[model samples]
Target chain A: MIPSSWYLILSAVLFTMGVAGFLIKRSLITVFMSIELMLNAVNLSFVTFAHDWHAVKGQIFVFFVMMVAAAEAAVGLAIIIAIFRTRQTLNVDQIDLMKF
Target chain B: MHLALFLIFAAVALAGAANLLLQKHPINAALSLIVVMSSLAVLYLLLGAEFLAIAQIIVYAGAIMVLFTFVIMLLNEGVEEKTHGSRVAKLLGFPAVTVFLALIASIILSSETHLGKVIIGESITTTQDLSAVLFRDLLLPFEITSVLILIAILGAVALARKDEQ
Candidate 1:
């Protein structure tokens, strides 16, 4: 079995990439995807610790996180669709209607 | 064996994440994100979280990404136009994020938290225990998730409907 810390290192790397994507990407949907990637990273870390501690609780937390992510994805995509209809564009720079 | 599996899938997940970030087309980015999620499911399997691995595939890769792709197709917004932010931000930001990752990795690596070195047996028993906890202790949260999903359904329909006045 690999050391649990290795799993954590991988998790951290995935999370950092997610954050960079969130910051550097231009589309609203890509930003949303980045958020999902971040959540996946957290889930991975949780599972790693769950394995390490031999407690099922961390995995349960991952379960709850997944539940919440599903709901968030549904609503977030709907809002994105609404914004697209209103703006006809996916560029985050153009999504500045409330930036005044 | 397990180390090799973890290394392979971890590479897949990271590469897919990078692809998601670099792709100019939202659809391509969404597809890359799906790859990330699927590989994460496999990693979850390697970590002995059986149920969660399946849930990651079904709910995340299957449901959530499909929703993203549907929205992408529905929006039909072609490749994103390049919007150049101020150069200083990029100059300062990329390295800052790299430093942050390095800091986090160092902390995680330096930690001496050793857990059950005893590799557990089949996850079949794990699943049974998980279900017991889910139904007994976690019932409230489980029910709440159903309500959250219901609200999401209502909200999505309300928002995406034609705004006929």
Candidate 2:
């Protein structure tokens, strides 16, 4: 059997990579993808703990998380498209309309 | 052994992440993200969170990622412009990422709580147990999720629509 620690470690690495990508990438789409990566990393941990506890609450929570993610993706992509239409670019640094 | 499976999935996830990071094409990156999400669902199954595994595949790999792909296609963000940041911002990214990583590592390591053996001995699995609790005690959240989805739909439409003014 795969030790739970290995799962935890892999999750940690993936989460770190996601964070790094989010911080480094300037494109809105890339940032959005990094966010998804981070969420999946969290899901990995939640499942690991769920298995460990032999409880379904964690799994149930993951379901809710997925729902939220779906919602976020839909709305977030729309916003990104709107921004692209107005700004003609997806680079966060170049588009500073919201920044004061 | 399960270790081999874990290694394989971890390799796949890493490859997906790399593709997401390195690929210039938004569509390709989106596809890679789907691969990563599906591999994660498989991992969830191994962890005994079967419901979550299935939900992950359906919600993430199936629904959200497809929406992302559509947005990419609609925008036609074919070639991503190289990222450029101010000197300070460029300097800040590494430190910020490092600090966040360190914080997560410390939190995980410092926590002393250990999970006890809870695996059902061929008698019960996660799906049945989760359904029981979800329907019996946590019914409110179950219902609330629908409201959340509805709101998200409205929000997406409102955001996509052009301003009247």
Candidate 3:
């Protein structure tokens, strides 16, 4: 039997790596991928908790989270494409039109 | 057996995530993310979330990653340029994150005793049970998510098309 907390710890480590990628990466697409990483980490924990408690709701919640992630990814990539079309650059630093 | 399997895949997932961070190109990062997602699916399988594991593979590794890869190829973007970034963030960011990670790990380890253990193939949530809960208990959210996907589709179309004069 593997302790469920180990899964949670792995999730946390993945989440932190996602955070680091999001903060440190310069490209728009890579940062977006970091967001996806964070979402996946959370899904792991949700499944872990569900298994720990022998409840199905956690998995159900993961399902919904995945749905939301899909929707978000579609719209976000579209927005990235739009920004790239106009800006002609994928760098987040260069795409800062609203920055004062 | 379960512990060994979990450790192996967890290591794979962590390595993938680290590579995602280290890769300078978006396509490479995206591919690494796929590795992480696949390993995570294996982890989910070990935890007996069979349906979710499959969904993770099909939805994440298959559909979403394809979308990401397509966008990367369509953009034809090159490697990421290095920026010095903000000095304050450089000074404080990693340490802050390390502190946060330590705090979270300590809390989880403290509660590890009672949080219980998961045996491989112990409690399988069949598709029927999953669908019953999804369609019956959470029907409204289910329908709403459909609408959300529709909105997403429409938004993507609107966003991607060229603006008319």
Candidate 4:
């Protein structure tokens, strides 16, 4: 059997990569994609824990997390589109209206 | 057999993540993200979290990735001239990322010391058990969270549209 630790390690690696990407990438779309990666990484760990504990709570929690992710995506995309229209660009450095 | 399969999935995930990082195009990154997400779903399945696996496929690979792709397409944000960070930022970021990764690796290693053997075994792999717990014990938060998500969605749309008027 593949050890549960392997899955957790992989999840951690993936999450770190996602975090690095989110912090380093300048493209708004790329940043959004990185955020998705982070979420998927979390799901991997959650499932791993669910399987280990013999309880279904973690799986159910994953279901709810997925639901929230869907809604977040819909709303996030709309905001991205709106910003794109106003700025005519999606570069992170260029959009500084909200920055003090 | 399971180890071999897990290795394969892990390899695919790494490749997808590399593509996400290396490709300059937003759409390509989004597609790679989907590959990574689907491989994660497979990992979930192998772990006996069938409901979570299906949910990962549907919500992440199906819904979220598609939304990302659509947004990338909608914006027509082609791979414009690649923007480089300032020299100072690049120099600082390299050390910062290295330290961060090191810290995470240490934390993970420390946690491994306390991990006991997996206990659930093969008996807990059914959908019925998951549904029962979800519907019975966690029903309230489940419903409330859905409502909260709905409100967030509406707020996002409203915020995005308000500028048009």
Indicate which candidate wins on lDDT.
3
Model 2, A46-65: lDDT tens digits are 77776776667877778878
The residue-by-residue lDDT of candidate 1 on B14-96, one tens digit each, is 89998998898989999899899999988888777889889999989889899999888887868866666524435667898
Off by over 4 Å in 4: A98-100, B86-90, B116-124, B161-165
- Which parts of model 3 have CA positions greater than 4 angstroms off? B86-89
Q: What tens digits encode model 2's per-residue C-alpha lDDT throughout B99-157?
A: 87777766665552453332323223556787898998899998988999999899988
User: After aligning candidate 1 to the native by TM-score, how far in Å is the CA of B52 from where it should be?
Assistant: 0.9
Candidate 2 all-Cα RMSD: 2.6
Name the candidate that leads on TM-score. Answer: 3
TM value for model 4:
0.90
TM-score of each: 0.93, 0.89, 0.97, 0.90
Instruction: Identify the CAPRI category of the predicted complex in candidate 3.
Output: medium
| Per-residue alpha-carbon lDDT of candidate 3 for residues A1-100, written as tens digits (9 for 90 to 100) | 8789999999999998888888888899999999999999999999999999988989999998888999999999999999989899988777767865
| TM-score, ranked from best to worst | 3, 1, 4, 2
For candidate 4, what is the DockQ-based docking class? medium
Recovered fraction of real interface contacts per model: 0.69, 0.65, 0.76, 0.54
Clashes of each: 0, 0, 0, 0
Worst 10 residues of 3 chain B by lDDT: B83-92
lDDT of 4 by residue, A1-100 (tens): 7567778878878887787777666788898888878888888888887777766777787788788788878787887888887889888777778766
| Model 3 Cα interface RMS deviation (Å) | 1.2
